[model samples]
Target: MAVLTASFFALLLAAAPAKAPNLAGTWRGGGFEIVLKADGSGTIKDSEYSPAEPLKWKASANALTITEEDEPVAYSFKQDGDRLHLSGGDLDEPVDLVRGAASAKASSKVDPQAAPGSAAKHVGPGSCDGACRHYLKCAGQPALQAQCVLACYSEGYGADFMGWFQSLDCVAAITVIAMLEAQSRGLQGGGGGGASQSKECEGCRWDGSSCAWYSQGNWGSNVAYSGAVITCNSSCCGR
Candidate 1:
């Protein structure tokens, strides 16, 4: 698989402004019993992680730990003073485990400090601009493209591509490849992004669920490959 390196949202528990130990109790919601105490000890009660085996957990920090056993059994959580927030492992990628048995993570963050009517806020490195972006800009050059093709082929795009693209002459075919890459845009917005299902159509931003195919323009089902059965495009990918 092509490894796309880019900035992505990492799940982490917000460090409470004040840390005491009142996190003890049978707090259950996203399918686990969350417990907290003065000693900073905690455990999420998972019943169906695995048969005959006790539930397991990994402490990511002094306040966070992931508990699970099966396919959809990955998760992390945190507490902002009085509010408790939790997210699962499959939040970014698509998890195709058992439906009823399929547990997934969350796409957004949970800030209990927000007012009841307040909106959500996300964190982490927002974009890649300096070095990484500079490298990708001139990657279309012939000499460079030539070297890349040879290297990529040896690494694989070679044996797999039996067409003229694999020919040495393709070193000068940078424009064609660049244009084709632009058309596909398959790997554009890296890391669990692109044409994933949006709540609305890009044209109308309708937040609709009915996504069509992927056409290019400014929008439409560009995220169809991410298992977006119905993309939320203006005309469902018909740009």
Candidate 2:
């Protein structure tokens, strides 16, 4: 009987699933950017309107727990190729995040004229336009000006929203414009845009009842909605 019991336990162990993959990289969604580290510690940067927060994380076989705001929130995640799909807790539907390269390294010893591939590039204040000049003046130094612009842009601020950026967030706008300018000159940052690059869904808007999601830059499908929140369907957004 003891031999039979041991055999049964071994079978159960063999049937168990393997642990989840290590999430030790940068992930970007529509409104959030998470940098999960190997040490279970990381930082989250919300939209330009919200301040960044540091948090600790723990991962199990199929779920991840984030300790933020003195509370633990659990999220079940699945990995599909280069995308990480997360769902649960406050999320009505799964949110897909594309894996990005590691965050920019510290700038203390970084060379100013290294290369365009370098995360931080020192630009003279005179190179900025009128809109960017206002923010650069307050930034004090040219290095700080560039850092400020990159910081805001990295937080996912680019196009001018209705009330998202009036004048205070001009730094973010300038950074995005500069990147576009560079791309036009065949000097795109982070190499040329590839399939991994995130593209904004064109023509995504609310009709009268449901949120309309577009595929191929035009209206394609509508997702039902009753609450104030509108969730994008994975079929449409999970590219």
Candidate 3:
């Protein structure tokens, strides 16, 4: 339960720009899919994230902003024809994406006014609501509580949580404790907490239902101790 210092938040606020480029399209790369709409609303799907995570986005001339719930994370971006490149945020390295056919309901037209997007939709610090709810679900399973809580916080706080704490020694301590707790609880398949007992293979990313491993370099999965699987990357833990 490490707290993010005020300076960290200040850094994020400073990274934001007054405007953004139109990124209305479907972009896919690695194990993630991002759909940016014309109206400033968007959805990001990643094997490591909750399915179809709702988001708001905007960009300056060279930066992209992604707002989840109500918190905004910024990344430098460049659009070249059908390819989109992104750096910063939670990425250990830059990610490249290719534009694909969007869903029928997805719009690509850019409305300059709509670029303001969903920021006004939320009042204050609402992302915690989603994170807290997920933490509660994980709490039901005694063996997996810590791992689950970690995941909840990671998603809820986004870069704020991941960018800071995951790089600390406490993260490893948390993972080790979670593993020991699981053994002490005698984790079995389909336990009383309704927790899944599936183990993530090394170098694979768990997509909630399955583990996906990519051959490309610079890819790794988060520590999944015992049956409580919270998959991310070693970079996220500052390995």
Candidate 4:
């Protein structure tokens, strides 16, 4: 009867449901963040500066579903150690998130940029001036300006929303800078012209030749750029 009992227990174990993966923690990537609680409640934010939105999530071994705005969205997910990769269901592209450290705490009252060890800090008074000057210096070179913006953002150069906006003015200053540079060089290329408007480039005007910036309604907003055309309400530069 011992053999019989052992086989019966094995069968029962086989019939039991598999335990869900442990996803209760904060995950962040590319300025987007999600905090999943053990109690199935959560919050998601598109950026470090944006407000969080409430959410409810349930997970199986290989799938995760999030309910927000009274609607349910599903995704196929895979976790490799502390890295989470999610795809499908309202996602145009896959999003990868890294698990926060053990001491990381996220809350409605917290400013994400102010988190411990966060790389978001100011450069004293008039922090925007440095970035604007950098843009002016690199006006003729798109590659240099792009690299400058990327480096500035990564180095935590801006103090607040206005400071961040001022840094973007670096891109705007390209017009005047390019114009003066061309005149000095006796080059035929001129600055300032109407670029083709699109949904992506809203709140920004791009000169046909080079340079683009937030002309209106781009405050405290993320932007996306495709070549010269800028996409509003999305990431500025993926680099």
lDDT of 3 by residue, 37-124 (tens): 9899989854322246678998778888899758799999888877788988855557666677632222233221111110111112
Quote the lDDT for 238 in model 3.
31
What lDDT does candidate 1 reach at residue 55?
34
Reference-based TM-score of each model: 0.21, 0.38, 0.41, 0.46
lDDT winner among the candidates? 4
Candidate 2, residues 186-215: lDDT per residue as tens digits?
323345344213222223355545544322
Candidate 1 lDDT by residue in tens digits, 55-81: 334444433443333423444555544
Pairs with steric clashes in candidate 2: none
Q: What clash pairs does model 3 have?
A: 19-59, 19-60, 20-59, 20-60
Question: Which of candidates 2 and 3 is the stronger one according to TM-score?
Answer: 3
Model 3 local distance difference test score: 0.49
Model 3: number of clashes?
4
Clashing pairs in 4: 200-230, 200-231, 223-235, 224-231
lDDT of each: 0.31, 0.48, 0.49, 0.53
Residue ranges of candidate 4 with Cα displaced over 4 Å:
1-3, 102-239
Best by TM-score: 4
